[model samples]
Target chain A: MEGIGIWGVPLAIFAGAIRVSTPFIFVSLGESITERSGRINLGLEGTLVFGAMTAYAVAVMSNSPWLGVLAAMATGAVFGLIHGFICKFPKVNDIAIGIAMMQFGLGLAFFLGKPFIQPVAPHLPSIALGGWSSSPQIQSALNINVLFIIGALLAVALWWAFKNTRVGLILRVVGDSSDAARAMGLNPDTVRLLATAVGGSLAAVGGAYLSLFYPGSWNEGISSGQGLMAVALVIFARWNPIGCFLAALLFGGAGALGPALQSVGVTQGYYLFYAAPYVLTLVILVVTSSPTRSLAGAPGALSITK
Target chain B: MTIEANIPTLPPLSAQSGNLRPILEWLARRAEPVAISLGAILTGLALFSIFITVVGKSPIDLFKLMYTGGFGSWFSIQNSLSRAAPLLLTALCVALPARLGLVIIGGEGAVVLGGVAAAAAALPLTGSVSPIIVLVVMAIAGMIMGGIWIGMVGVLRHYRGVNETIASLLMAYIAIALMNHFIEGPLRDPASLNKPSTTPLPAEYMLGSIPGMDVNWGLVIGILACIVSWILIEATSFGFAARIAGGNVRAAQIQGLPVGRLIVGFTALAGSFAGLAGMVEVAAVQGSANASLAAGYGYTGILVAFLARHNPLAIIPVAILLGGIDASGGLIQRRMGLPDATVLVLQGTLFVVILFCETFYGRFKIFNPDLWKRTA
Candidate 1:
């Protein structure tokens, strides 16, 4: 491979980060909303995979990638509904149920996705942000997906809504204290159920991005635990949507490090770089965690914090 | 609450029933878990049938194929038993840590690392060492690596207040990555060009089949490990302390039990069992550490542990049951034209329904002798 200039690696990483972080951004933002409501849906891994399959299958059948995204969102919401309803019952551990749901989703996807694997679906449209640049490398690298822009806007909107909207306040109140919500005559279960449903839909959008955009395809190995990592990303971001977006970019950069280095002909420990997100998440968790006290900004009623 | 007062008064049940009272009480005491678990299994089956029906396959045919492939003949039973061997140990990995109220789901990491460590240990003594000595060294290496792998999760949870579930899962991912790095790099055998793997064990050093059985010694070892773990958990003071800590960590701490030590020790032991399963796979089955070593035994073990309610002894039967389900996958695919993921769907459904049924526990007064006394 011809060596790119010294600045090429960094530039490549930046471009890769943008291309790769879309799913992370959506999933983490969704998880942030869900966690903000005091419930953890570890099963998002399943939701993400199922979404990828649904999106790919629908896009192939309908010849419309946008419809694929919508179908995935609907499927994801149904999964979230199942999770939320089951978790509503007393003594049902959300985390375990999440794992079970993950398996179910993955199994269902693989079983159903057998045919879609061989067919090609239309890729999601992307903007030629690097059209002005002379370099093809930069041009291709900077071609941003529309979903990335939408994800950024979603993050900003969520951040603003969490502080300014009455609906957001109700969600926070329900998350902070179920008793308080109940005292105010609000059914905490309903609120949480809805929050989880919305979260699930958002996460499916992330999956649609994966299958219909960057590395666009339907495969069992397409998602390397991105859904699960979103949970950790949410924590590191302190449950803030914009922070999730930024953290996702950081993770995407980490994920891109190996490919960028390999492009630059530095192949040593390439496989290890795939673990960068997980390791970073672990470090962040350890640093933020306190043995005697819950992390700052953690919802009062969150099972993880307790 | 209202129903208790409405019960018809007759002779005290214990006095009237005589010997039957004790038997009935015993049955009632155990009935809750049995009934709830059976209900969960049936519900899961029903849901899975609907899924199967939706997919244009007959659920009756699928179930029939599962039974025939899993338990129909002597050969099928042997296959299921062989598959259940690793699960026995891996399930213990979850069951033991669960005794300390920790959810350590990363046993897969330990299994992968342990297999790598065992392979590395055996490579040096390929020809010179006694086969038995080589096996011992491999087991020790595997156990230590596995122990440290899971022990870190315990230490992080207890000292740093990290969530055991997430931390362990992340560690598992890291461990798999590291294993891949080694298998594809430093440890790669030149002969393994198509698929990266460590050096295979010599034929003489490989674990052999048991007498009159097609299954390897791993099955026996797994059974023995379960027996030992059961005794350790149910009959010892340390186990008693661990159970107490599991119930209430503050109470255990107040009672001067070393809660941190218990957590780390139990997790380490659990990891070691999982690690042993890895070694057994490499030694008795695969004969080398490779990508295949990460064959999801760790994940399946989670289902087994939960289905068994994290009971060490109960894990034996549960592991076998799941193993049968797994063994039937290929046959179901071949015969019914359904995908191999069919069994996975069943397992996942069972897992969800079973966890949901946890709410039913302590709900029925008939299952609680204490409630009966109140009525009396």
Candidate 2:
């Protein structure tokens, strides 16, 4: 604390932003994909928590973190499938079902995760990008996890595929108008279901990142509403995968603000500072939301926008 | 006299003929919700039993212990009642707004803030004011704070078109953070080292039990609140308007109903109930505002309201029933070697199944009077 100079706070925040934003990146991107399909999955919070538990438990049992991640993705896909199938029924509210699914997922996780709380599972490996740096602080700060890089690449890939692929065209059509999709001889239910499954798997990977990498551990309190927040993040991102990535970073930076300030001996009201991300999100929503009009880039079939 | 005799007067109808059809029709109308909910609960229980068996536990023994712990004895019943007290008010937090088709799940935020506000308001009056006055002030403070906290969600939903569910939840997180900040910093009681609680109310200032019963006044207050809410929703024009709005917002607006006001007003009223529950907890249970204020009662209230189908009167029975299940957790944990989360699992299962059963409503021809008329 004594030897570190004026650059300490900025450096800490930059590193913290990267570390915290990784999960957000994955989740927001996942939610972006789901919402783009004209459906919203608020149950992602439950999925994320359940995924964390599954990852941790599997890691402990199989002695392999990768296997644990795969298990989490599989469970998450199943949860997504349930949500998609249930919501496919006429007069069924997606948002309400999402809340119910969230509770179910959380309950299931807590019930099974009680046993995995104590055991130490292997952590995901990191690539030390700061090896070239002479200062130990810089080196430590630059040790980025592998999932962040993968998530970034996935965002780019999704952006590219949405513009160039036939599957992307079908997804866009199904999301924008189910009636149109039917006219085009496509099954909107199946398309949305598959999209939601993919989204859920992606969100689970985000949870895996949490338990296997940064702040890495298997615990009931691991999520703190990150999965839910990602929904709002996707809104702020305006349904674009690249925008989702940026918004996640912004949220991540806000999330890291308190720790960065505390690192520099600014401890007063730190708990309030911990709420920066939520406050920022709420403020953004308020500013962007219009009572008379739907959001600019919202999908036509999205119930939440309506 | 001859003209009067020519005017035929039929004999008075029998009592059975006068009342039977209406009663039958009422029963027919109510049969769907009751039957569906019962079926859902049974299915949930069966699923839970299967899970228990898979985990190597005997479901029969667990059920026996649950009953014994929840209601088998006078002591257990009292415990269940005490637990149900907060639930009644919190369930109203969800139930009231639900009438207007708004889902406000942030009652937990209101409860925490309300508890903190009550404690803060009580700090200056310690030993200087009448206990009853202090209690009244605390209740008002709690209600005001909680109402404002949740009213913002309603306002946002109507005015800004923000999603109420997401906004309310995010606000809940913020409220918790605020409570933690204040409790640990500005409001920290010097004597409280580990838990970081506010100053405790004196024993005499604390709420007392009924003359002969062990349960505190919170139980009575909760029951009274439920009755009052029931009257508000059932016997008032305001409730009628809200119900109309819930059924179809466009029609409500076309009828010139103040939809925005109704949303804000109902949400505020609901928040006040949750706030009152917080005050009751501070006065009757914890005696101070702390992290313990978030005992998950607010979230459980959502389940209770849903289980009751968002009817204020129905909430009473559902809250008590769930309270019994919650009260049985410790007994099950101790006797059957099951984790405390087993109750949560059961609750989650019940919530999911009940919601899924919502699709069953109005689907049966027997429940529809129009269909009955066609058949007749």
Candidate 3:
């Protein structure tokens, strides 16, 4: 903030994008997986919040951040399992079921997280990538977390896997048509169940990143619908992992607009800028989506896009 | 829509039983939702009881407190009723759009913006006009704001093929942000420093309650809205067209139905009810627009709408029942050392179970009306 002047806004926004975009990257990538498997889990918001609570609580108890991340991943998987299991039943609406699961996860988290609100937990460490910079602002801005690097690599790996792996082929097949997957002697339900669980776990990692890094706190207001926003981001990304990564950064930048502008003394009506991400999401959906046809790259069996 | 539960083709009772078979079949068809929903509640309560027991709290005491707080007495009943008022309107928000094959979860945003709009409208005309006129203007302003907000979701769904559920929810977050902008910056009452709020309505301008009642006028308004909505959907041609579109958009298009207009109209109408709920809160409860306007009545309305199977008439009892559970939250917390979110847990469990029960409908032969026909 000091000595940066008006140039601080864009620099701050760029730095903030990298910092805030980690959770979006993880959740959108996870949602991309679940959507590709033809089951959209809108309850990932609940999973994200519950994962934050779990990670913070576990980190406080075990005095280990990595253990907290693992614990969060475990609970997220369980949440997805429950969602996937119930949705497997005929006549059940997956979207509604996701809403129910979200409420359940939120209730469970708040109830159990009552005790851990006060205890400060050990947080994840960050790598200083701006050692060459003499300015403290730039240096501090470049102090990126280890989880973010892992997320970037995960995006590349997932993109490759979706193209080259056998598991990817099965997932794509099941997503396209349950009947065709069954014809190929594959259990669509099982594949979707596993995909949803993996998606849930990745979403939890995003939550862990929030609690154990970035803001580094555990509270009820830790998430501001970012979990839900990831659902839209997945669509904006066209279901590609690399696209999801880029989309996350874009949304992250949009989200940071309000705070970044305010830092440079442009506080007038800046709260409206806080809405930039949502407006951007709406615009993206409007531009890309169509009334008569399915979105390009959307899985054939996905209930939502249809 | 979820309200379209198919009637059983077979009679639930045998003709060899008695002359009461027809009556029994009628009862069976009508009572199917009631019976299943009741079972879901019991199962949910049982699950919650297990959680309570595991946490070392006595489940019996919690239930007793809930009864006293929610429905065991007249005062609690009034409390529940007052709470149910807004739920009635917000439930309509979900129920209405649902008829057009849309899921609009952003009703909360509509409610928030509606309150802001109502407050803004009243601020300019408060002293210039009569109180009743102010109130009427408030309602219309709220409705218009809410309608436009949710109508956008409808337009997006119809014109752009956007997923209404996610789109609506995104709008809600955006609404909340805009609301904060107005509340914190533009509409802040200079005298009120601690909690940011709009200019308060004068005491005479506030909505009063019914005679010999603790509840405000919002409850009656909510009830009337529900009845009108029921008639609109069940007895009117507009409702029929909406239903046809809901059943199949392609078929409706083929039949030359104005499917796009129907979608937008239903969603706008639904958003109106939710917006009205926000106006009620401003006029009857809070007396001003503030952050509390985003008090989650919209989300709870979703639960009520679903539990009622999206039937406007059924939304009445369902809203009251859910409101009672919400009213009992504080009691459960004080008596059982459990957090108030215990109610949310119960609600979530019930919602899940009720949805799962959809699979059971038309599966059991005992609930079938065609059985009596065969036996006869």
Candidate 1: tens digits of C-alpha lDDT, residues B1-376: 3566466864465445665767878999898899999998999999999989998889998899999889988899999999999999999999999988888889999999999999999999879989999999999999999999999999998999988888888898899989989998899898998889999999999988989988999889888988998899899999999999999999999999999999999999999999999999999899899999888899888878887888888999998998899899999989988888888788888888999999898899898765676323
Better of 1 and 3 by lDDT: 1
Q: Which stretches of candidate 3 lie over 4 Å from their true place?
A: B1-20, B192-194, B371-373
lDDT of 3 by residue, B184-209 (tens): 88997877678889999998888889
Clashing pairs in 2: none
**Alpha-carbon shift of residue B165 in model 2 (angstroms):** 2.1
- Say which candidate scores most in lDDT: 1
Model 1: CA > 4 A from native = A1-3, B1-14, B373-376
**Model 2 chain A weakest lDDT span, ten residues long:** A1-10
**Candidate 1, residues A194-293: lDDT per residue as tens digits?**
9999999999999999999878999888887889788778987889899999999998998798889988788668889878878987898899887899
lDDT of each residue in B1-376, candidate 2, tens digit only: 2243344763444665555756767888888788988998999899989999999999999989999988989889988888899999999999999889888888999999999999999999989999999999999999999999899999999999887877887788888899988888899898998898999989999989977878899989989989998898889999889999999999999999999999999999899889889889988899999999988788778878877888988988888888888899999999988988788788777777787788888787777644543112
Per-candidate alpha-carbon RMSD to the true structure: 2.8, 5.3, 3.1
Clash pairs (backbone) in predicted model 1? none
Best TM-score among the predictions, by candidate number: 1
The DockQ-based CAPRI class assigned to model 3 is medium
How are the candidates ranked when ordered by lDDT, highest leading? 1, 3, 2
